[model samples]
Target: MIDSPKPTSLKAVMETLNAQEAAKPSSGLTSKEKRARTVARLVLVQALYQMELTGTGVETVIREFSDHRFEGDLEGEKLADADEAFFGEGARAIVKEQATIDRLITDRLAAGWRIERLDTTVRAILRSGAWELKFRPDVAVEVVINEYVEIARAFYGETEARFVNGALDGIAKDTRG
Candidate 1:
């Protein structure tokens, strides 16, 4: 008889990730408060997707997520707690500035692939990264690129991560330089 392990649910996967993050020796990330900003970036990508898929206003979705999703247990599982300010910044500012971001993304793409044709999750990663590169000069460019590349890996395989690296690298070079 053969027994196979059940597929890991997103919740269990996330819990494992949180534990792993807790275990990482605090070198560059000197405090949990600093780490929360990275958590907010990940959550911002997810919230951006939610806003696009649903017709929810940015403020409404942010309110809903802030009130009920960030710090509470929803559907019997603990929710991802992230920095509230960064979440609002990405959801509202990123979506609002999407047209400009898309233009930058479009310039970097190959001849046939339009930005709209890209996968939503991938697009979200790029948009958030682009937003940071163009707007958040306080964070270093390499830091912004690497963070989104990791986020891409969390959702996709090596191919997608490479793709993200290329696009973000191109944008970062053009914009940051």
Candidate 2:
């Protein structure tokens, strides 16, 4: 169990998270909308990975996802419907500005650690996180870092999540500050 104000079972944890989200007064987004966006980000990273591995074009990948992918389970877990418009827009924008996004990520990576040297999943995470940092000014830097770090945790352990956090934090400093 994670450190928290009170120890919680896995089931209660969702309620706790929902309560916490409800307490955030600054957010105009409803919890369902926020969940959909989070799902969208997860799906977006997968789409990016697929495009890289299969040499698929952006439109084709986006269309494929919209038509056949988003409504179903992901990795055995039930997922909320992804924000399809957000997913498509983000994928297109990222591909369009990928060179710049790659450069931003490459610069944040440690010396001797090239963007291409990273695991493909990590690369996808960094690319999408970097794109959001540079392009999505409406999202707070902390939210971007936290969301991507959570995505990293889904695929890896604490160490990779920390690496993603540091990399995105660096990118945020350069792009958001």
Candidate 3:
């Protein structure tokens, strides 16, 4: 059984990560490594959502997740073991680079469709996907787009998933082109 880490303010999570060393994913991952990465992306989106909703800092969120959330079960649902480093590094980068990321997303958004107008969950999903597309060259753009689409589907219907796909697709073409 995993012990729940005490919840710190989400702001602490961002601050903690801001001070931590940079984290990045490596290539030539094994199947387990790939699964872990997938889990990391899912968790990253959740963390981002948590941060936005609570105005939490990146570091506190990452610590909370690493200590409590990464144990393969969240709220009685079994989860794949997540890549802690990837989650931490990605979270840090996402928060730190959020302005630039938001710009990328805003640029790809259809005219008159501001990113802020999107659902908070959808915004978090797009932010995570955009980060990977722009920064994680080790990961393929197709994989990044598909993974986030599935993540969106987990939280929403096909409409949102397709929206995530289209938004990330545009970002990928711009970044990975």
- Give the winner by TM-score: 2
**Clashing pairs in model 1?**
none
Clashes per candidate (backbone, < 3 Å): 0, 0, 14
Q: Which numbered prediction scores highest in lDDT against the true structure? A: 2
lDDT of 2 by residue, 1-177 (tens): 011111112223234344555666656687887766777877888888888888889999888877777666654434446688888889999999999999999998878877888988899899999999999998777667877887776677679889999999999999987
Using lDDT as the measure, name the better of candidate 1 and candidate 2: 2
Where is model 2 poorest over a 10-residue stretch in terms of lDDT? 1-10
lDDT of 1 at 128: 92
Predictions in order: lDDT: 0.73, 0.77, 0.75
- What lDDT is reached at residue 74 by model 3? 47
> What TM-score against the true fold does each predicted structure earn?
0.79, 0.86, 0.81
Backbone clash total for model 2 is 0
Q: What lDDT tens digits, residue by residue, belong to model 3 across residues 55-93?
A: 779999988887777765544333446788998899999
Scanning candidate 3 in windows of ten residues, the lowest lDDT window is 1-10
lDDT per residue (tens digit) for residues 1-177 in model 1: 111121124354345445655675554655565556667777778777777667678898789878777776423434454678887987888878989998889988999889889987788889999999888877777667767777777677678889999998999888888
